[model samples]
Target: MYYIENVDRKLFIYTIKDVYRLEASMQEIEKMTADTDLVRISRTCIINTDHLKEIKQVKNSRLEAVLDNGEMLIVSRKYLQDIKKVFRRDLS
Candidate 1:
């Protein structure tokens, strides 16, 4: 599962089959899910690294994470280092 904050500022829990509303902030979810597969990829998105399918360089030094479910999410340059660390840890 993954957690994302929509444009309406509402949190949603995304699963492979469904999306349910979550009544929690992204920060709270991030902390609680820390040490797990969840990794913050941007200000509004926290993805399950286990679900990551591909990381592609999109231009301007930004990246795009394609999830197993075929969802593509942006990885802003600000969070690039952190995402790289996740990949390194996984690879190691």
Candidate 2:
């Protein structure tokens, strides 16, 4: 999966070319994928780091993840350190 997003209380899974509805909460999915490449980047988004191309800083202090498919997702302040540890790359 490329990413999972929760919008308006519903969850959708995005892949390279298609999207599917998933019948599970974010917490549950996170727990199940804890040992995998999937990592929660925001309250509404959990991304597959294996599909990540790069992450960069945008305006302000926000971090943005760019996927291999050329999609972008915001990395929130609350999960900055968590994401950094996963990639272990310099954020400067």
Best by TM-score: 2
Backbone clash count, each prediction separately: 0, 0
The positional error of residue 86 in candidate 1, measured at the CA in angstroms, is 2.9
- Please give the TM-score that candidate 2 achieves against the real structure: 0.86
Give the range of the ten consecutive residues with the poorest summed lDDT in model 1.
Answer: 1-10
Candidate 1 residue runs with Cα over 4 Å from true position: 59-61, 90-92
Off by over 4 Å in 2: 88-92
List TM-scores for all candidates, in order.
0.82, 0.86
lDDT of 2 by residue, 54-75 (tens): 8888866778999998999999
What is the per-residue lDDT of model 1 for residues 4-85, given as tens digits with 9 covering 90 to 100?
6554789887886788898888889888976666788888988888888988887656688898878899887787777777
In order, the Cα lDDT scores of the candidates are 0.80, 0.87
